[model samples]
Target: MSTHKPLGRFLTAGAVAVAMLATAACSGSTEPSSEVTELTVILANSTFTENLPALAETYKAETGITVNVEAYGNEQLNDTLKVKLNAQSDEFDIFGYQVQDVMREFVRNGWLTDISDYVNNSGDWDWNDFQESARDAVQLDGKVYGVPVATERHIMYYRADLLKEAGIAVPTTIDELEAAAKALHNPDKGFYGIAMRGARVPLVTQYSSFLYSYGGDFQDEAGNSTINSEAAVQAYNTYGRLLHNYGPPGATNMGWVEASAIFAQGNAAFYLDADSQAYTFLDPQKSAVVDQVAYARFPAGPAGSHPYNIVFQTLGINSFSQKKDAAFDFIKWVLNKDNAKLLLGEHTLPVARSSAWQDSSATEKFPAGLVEIVRDTDSNYVGHDRPQLEAVARAREFVGGPAVTAIEGGDEAAVKAAAEQANTEFQALLDTEKR
Candidate 1:
């Protein structure tokens, strides 16, 4: 569980460059410089990518290096990296990836470099400064694989004006939340009570918080599927009931953009999704309820309030890259605490560094209520928003099938049967991985 260990007593000559980073860091020198003068970095089209061009320019000015930056859409990045890395092409020295989706698979395939020495030995990089949940996402079997760059968590978004008009308090428990949804629901007026992702694959991540708080998980202690556990059935029913009964008519087709739009357009009283959606809800260009939107922790369920605070994006060095030193240095420079502030303060994006959250720059930039919710959920948060599996997409599709049924107005018996069927398939997938 330790990310940092005393610099190993004995070191190979190949480790000299890595070991030197500690001494330079102790003196607070800018991250180590590499002789390599050019590097290519592939990144997803994310909010954070906007900061990189300027950073690359600054780094070039300081280090005489040329950074070639290429960006792709989410699906494009996943597909591109799969083929590029599988062929062991070193066209890119570094890459930004969706941590939850492919980190385990990449690690298994040895596509990512083990940067344990770089992360652990550097006082400047300060691995311990990262949130525990963020750190856990990049580690497997006590080895460091990548650095988490973006963080997000599920939270409740509500229309404060509507809640006040309805005379219902912000819910603290699942039952109270359901009651509030029921009381506020009014489809005739074209205003439903709740909104959330309902598309089968997309819903799996959001439902994970519900699943955990209901005392169920994708797998039990022994890596067996629990999709049909009593707690899981209860979670599926509650999530489905809210979206099916109190949500929009076509919620089965909605993902984040679609579902959150309902809340932003003033058609829903409450929404549960990533806290990142708060910015969208607050945007005057897009939101009809800009002034009325507010934030709260995910309501407690039978098990307690276990919301997901997960690493949404990560940076990894290509295992086959000839410029590993330059790649590591570039990672350290861009993901430094100083840069984290740029992401948090200027962009209002959630960051992995704890210090960035405490800075006044970041504090003044984010909504006070949203920051409070982060403080409350940060301590007791789940690490992964979906099942922790190598074949995560397939697992999500299989396990999430029941939630889709529940959302389509399936009865209890039908939902139970779907869960049983999904569990058998999910179990087979798990067993294959185990073998």
Candidate 2:
């Protein structure tokens, strides 16, 4: 969701082809033109989705069905799905969505066709290949609505050469993370300590790791608002201070893409972003510090490093589709081991398959310890990056305002006041949704 802004309209085929590799399957008059079935898929134009046309072409060649792929920006796709699916339009047979952000509304509106039977009845699909956390996220009222497409967690990406120059080891705790940033900071020399997401919306995902590590969250276990807790205040203060004091100029204007670019270009010593962003950093053509990049777990706080390990994207069949079976087939085809291997080869986000992560070919593709960090974090401490409430997108807007202000160097008093106001407003919105 943090790459380029999602265009509100369907993307062009050429645009999708940029990041995708398509292959034609063996076909010699297996089925006549009249017997072809066409299924449409709509998804966000991310690394995974952009490359999906390749799988679609393979599916088409296998079954003689024409698979049409349509992609929109993440937010735009969410809004488009909301509007189009609510009307029960059959324009798309299947779609992918941000699970935590949009599933609540999609489930409530009954726009998704439940695919539990497809999951439960298929053994070769190795339904168990998916991690439990990922499987659980796509379910609603104990029924599976979608198949998880992409899963990720926030991890630390640092300049190994810079750390060595500073005579420091990789940070393991919140205090060390701060020290590392402060020590490497040299504004006069045009280098920053850290490159962090600060734009209002995308900031929410980055802040979640800090918030959880400090033992604060959007709500308590009982679902009451905890945005104004003492831990909340401290977490906000620490995050704000790190960026305002040691971050690049105009830090508040940056999201993951901007911040990660700064890190990849060697302007910052450390960057906090999703693991998928590492692809750009590792690509020599896309980065200046490719060989200097290294990965680490999100630095631990007093509560330990509880990063958001979320199945961020999922594919589902539309309830209104006349081609639900074909849609499910397409979903299966895309996530199968061979296709996942292809995605891994492209250095995209690691998928939900444990076996995939353990594959030698997949492991050897990246920096030494990335797959290990991805594996450990995936199996250990991870949660939803955001709340799964009906009002989540709106909630992020209000709840995230204070962090944005703090990162912009607002005075302590003003930042605290903003948090207090956001707490009340956020609770009110959550309460409205509950009622």
Candidate 3:
């Protein structure tokens, strides 16, 4: 989690659209009707949930549908959903989930509805408006299971004051980024060259862009592990060396919350992670480098700056829900173009709508520099951040072993051996799934 703060309680109709979408799942109506008067929704602890109550309030006023929201932490939400869906509970009509982490697992478990036919049949909801990657993120076996809520990518956060004071231009390539980090590194004075997730499990997603930019991937088309490939080894080497050489000590236990705090407190020169955390740095109350910070696209590596452009959050209807049509109606309304613009404009949330990206007025809330960077990176990005598997958590632990070794300052040979070991174990895991 990014340690993100929620929006204001009374934001407006746009903020509550999420609640409407979830509520849509529980109502047992063939079409829009007065019979479906209330809806129950479950959500992970997020910015969306912060506004959920007020959002549901607005929805109720507009459509007379009362939307009840239950917010839980990510782990708890997963566990709760599993328990409830296992009993085929219809307590929640719809819910929000991390697409990459749980979509495949949910689909396989028959926990989500295949809304493809109805979604495609709609005249107003232009499904094509979503990014190709976002659209694909919600699908399994050619069946659409959910609607994407937002698009996310890895972005670089840098100390603008430090770079300028040191007479260094913003780095454009990975090599230059290292050179700049080296120039600015002053750990003896309590400042370091860079910061990033270093803990083995959480590091995988941030490490993904490095893997891709070096022409490596977690797996190949044949579903075999590629984590120990020549390119992969090099990528692991670069990530490990940077953290070991420049990051804070005891970084092995640090996740985004800790690592990002280092940079936010003005203790690091560069930080690389999900763009969703940008707000943590931008909020003056939570940061020391508010004005000193600047945004950049992930610096290009050997292959290029191929950050993961992913649909991090998505809304899905309960497969067991009797009010399937009502749920679809809610989704259609919640994800409509107008509501997308409202989210982008008010909350600075990066949405899945390409048309929304073109709305300059809506994008102005983001830094001028960021708008350009996101626009360029959005067009050139890989679809998944971590290994795309049903067992994502386990896969992250496996693929990240070499990076952990690298971060601990292992020699190239040791790192390579770790990659080899991890790859073998990961392959075994994959093979089991095939059987």
Candidate 4:
């Protein structure tokens, strides 16, 4: 999935600048010798937002640093960070960045300071605690750029009860999967065989899983675009057929949120998505079919089994932040074993630390499936070829624009042509950015 979660427009550049100016002005005049130094943090607006204020209060009580937290949607925060960093302003002390693709530019430009020295020096913090892959995602050219807060792995979630009712077993192969979908599909009754993400980014992410199953990657290790290969064409065709024939009406408009909602609402026979959606799907308050859900590995493809893993949003200190030391300390304190346990207890995000995964208290609180997901990830995971910032942007634009046109316009020829165009543009982008 390229690790870049879509950042929605929630906060504007002007708004962030105004907010920072106000905070700086307030801090400058009133608090010259105050015991607490206010640290400004930019974070994603998710369920975790509720936990921050409480964590901040506790941190203040313990260490006496008053933390000022501002929440933005994922994309909004990235945009804000980009604007501030490009201007070389220390407006934000820390930013929550997910995709390494987005962070690559900052790392390459030396706009992000390496915190490896700080992490190594901390007596209480154990760098070995984090999962190797999750930790590796934040490392560039053998230096740590950020600390991961949580991780996610994708899996197949199905309704066991519905499958039994239909007298169909969980399909393990591509053909079997299609048969299962056909058996479960009931358009008149408002139930779909499967709920797939047909929307822009979600489509690209979900499509990649299928593409991988067919032994096709967006790029090989040598970083060449393979989108129009025979295997890729087959995978794309399969996706199109699934969406057109088995999915619900208006499926083209459904993103992760809508897809998850359809599955949780008891109308979907199977849903494949990131494991992070587990809590919401199982929550009785959120899901209508909470008790009917069952989890399994991704269905096998022509080549072999292929499932996608999504690591959690990473926490990075602004390279320009004056509070570099304090920021590193805060990161250590938050991601360390004890605090991670506490956070997992409240909200069941998979901690990046392997040691934290082994905690009995954590096992008692989080779902057993979470541990399984983590294990499966550690053992059998494949990552996208890390793309440069421009290449990654081109991929997003190409996939998003073409996939949307195909689904909404219902023109296969147009879709194929668009894909070709996108591939051409992607190659051009790579050529231009070649070092």
Candidate 5:
């Protein structure tokens, strides 16, 4: 039985500022108070929660600073952060920001504290340890806004046994991929040719990978929306074809959980999803096709291969935190190679540090194919931004709405029109944020 407790009260910026001042005043007294300083931290409820508290406990043992850690589910954490920011409050000294797109808005609004100086000044901190794409996602202007924790790249996970049985080699191009999907599809046996995330947000992330691969970008380097370009339409049309022809029947409602489950259960021939799923599909305890799973790079599109790679949740210190020094110390300690190794070993999450990736223990735990997937992440990394975010949401809506209509024997012209309309709405949203 899992017992859950209500997370503590949200801290507002005003309240945090008052607390800092109070702590400072108390520290100046002749009789130094022996009371422990409590720092509030809000983190998403995921694999992170399993280990962060233990790490916090270690920090307290060494420094006497007590950390009150609270965990919220993904949507809950985002909602809470937005509400707190809207109220101009800093209830938590440290926040775990998920999507880079959302973090950009937080950075723009001055909600997150800039950690560049601290990272630069720290003798132990190595900025080069992080992947360039992962680091770039958290940077606003020239200042870094967050410390990335884990990064995952999109890849094609296929059943090597099934491919061998079907007499098809591993696919390198989009056409080859489609042919393989068709060859391996067994609908009567509850199998799917391809399993992709079809739920709104998840589907959008999957689409971004393909869209970029097809030489379609959400925005140009100058920040103008490019989602309505011919390349983009082609990418969307291809996505519609996949859903309509080869994908799982219930794909529209499928997210990572469903897609991963389909692959793990050996009911899907191929899965286009994050590299993180490799661990699950290869785990004997969790997967029926543990020995049969094989990974390949994201299939190449007409334009080229432009798979999406993104760091998962990243932690950032609140700019309003009076305990900036303490915060820096905390992040540096947790992100250290030794600590990172432990986290990765326990959670199967990729660490931000490159050195950690080379750890002998890690190599023993993860597969060589998985390591190749991580290394290949550099080849097709695309930083998530507002345009990507908006375009993804719009793409998903258009797909599930009119695209589904077309798939179920509705009007193709109407589906195309709806897709165009969705693109226009997404472009308008992007326009509002342009500098």
Candidate 6:
């Protein structure tokens, strides 16, 4: 496993222009030449995408194809790709995507080319090696749109020493979670019950676990908004009460990084987010509760623990790119079994390959039973962290407003009113997209 290199800073407007200039210089001609083709692959700067430059070098050496890898922060990359794809510019041949993040809009706008034929004819690629949930995430209208790069699921992180001292068993249900939190909370000792994501955008991802567990979804089966359902109202109230009454002060302002820091400092008993962040909680250099931390499945609600199992990263070619074949070759090359193993070993994060998870050498890299827990959540919990929609950003914003209000000590009536208003506006957005 190679050490992950620090990602380049976010591309400024001028930086984007400079990157474009570099790509133009490398791209020999608009038409594919038999000699060599320089491919521009833009991806979010993540552990999953961090080693791409090395892989690109390998690809370039094996085949005379130069892959110019450009990495950006998640939100920044999403916005940049959206802008470039909408303009139908040939700035990039391939880009990394999140099925939950932008796939709905990208697919709807015809910005992504259908790779069904490529997937069907790839004899060397074992499609069955992918988990069904992961495979399903990258599909639309029964067509394979992209290859799964990596998968993530929400899991509970808890302070084992604190739980035992408080005489609380591991919480398995929402009621149990609240009771344990109340019992463990001690402001005088500077310990809070749970450090949860409460800020707007970050709140949505963690909140979705609670929402689905309560038998509420962002949209109903027919694709209409259900943000104000009775189940949703109850879920929001519970989610709000847990943090408002028992969480650390200024809980409403905390995102993943902030909340995780609180937990890592041993100030909170429980923190729930993507399981991939376990390394941060267990790393001795970064965490005060290093050896005291433990993992658990997301606590159950009325509907049971339907934690979000999202394929957080995927790779696909641009619909407007002339070098679709070359892009396809790049994707296939990057996702091959050996390369997948290399990424899993280097990143120590979960990849989309089923075989990678089951391999003893890869499993040994994680804490005991942690690998099995991840595999369990990945297979059993079949839900997304966010609503799947073309207007996903707008939808998250609408509902996130109420989430902020509810989590910040608003009364039940106020939360209900906000939910109702958000539901109406969200439905309107969905309706417009439908038309």
2 or 3, greater by TM-score: 3
Model 4 error, position 124 (Å): 7.0
Candidate 3 residue runs with Cα over 4 Å from true position = 1-35, 61-64, 377-379
Candidate 2: pairs in clash = 6-73
Clashes of 1: 0
**TM-score, each model?**
0.89, 0.83, 0.88, 0.79, 0.82, 0.85
- lDDT per residue for candidate 1 within 150-248, as digits (tens), equals 788889998899889878899988888889999999999999989999999999999999999998899987889999999999999999998888999
Cα deviation in Å at residue 209, candidate 1? 0.6
Q: Which tens-of-lDDT digit does each residue in 1-435 have in candidate 4? A: 012222212223432232222111111122332333778778787545546666666556556788888998877877887788899887677777775457678786666768777665555466777766676677776788888787766678888898888788887777787889888899899998888888766587777777788988776556666676666666767777777788887877789998889999999898887777787877888899877888877778897766665455778877777777666656665566665665554466576777766766665655565566565565344443223344575566665555566556446676677667766776666666666
For model 5, residues 85-140, the per-residue Cα lDDT tens digits are 77766556788887554776677677787777666655444677777788877777
lDDT of 3 by residue, 64-180 (tens): 888788999999999999999999998788899988888888988889988887667665467888887778778877899898888788889999998989999999888998899
What is candidate 6's local distance difference test score? 0.79
Q: What lDDT would each prediction earn against the true structure? A: 0.82, 0.77, 0.82, 0.68, 0.69, 0.79
Q: Which model, 4 or 6, shows the larger lDDT?
A: 6
Instruction: Tell how far residue 212 is off in model 1, in angstroms.
Output: 0.8
Candidate 1 weakest ten by summed lDDT? 1-10
* Per-residue lDDT over 323-381 for candidate 6, one digit per residue giving the tens place of the 0 to 100 score: 77777767776776656666676567578887777777766778765687766745557
Q: What is the clash count of model 4?
A: 1
* Candidate 3 clashing pairs, residues 3+ apart or interchain: 16-55, 24-327, 26-93
Ordered by lDDT, highest first, the candidates read 1, 3, 6, 2, 5, 4
Candidate 5 residue spans exceeding 4 A from truth? 1-38, 86-91, 188-190, 199-201, 283-286, 385-416
| Residues 251-274, model 2: lDDT tens digits | 878888899889888999999888
lDDT of 5: 0.69
Q: Which 10 successive residues of model 5 have the least lDDT summed? A: 22-31
lDDT of candidate model 1 versus the reference: 0.82
| Cα lDDT for residue 183, candidate 3 | 91
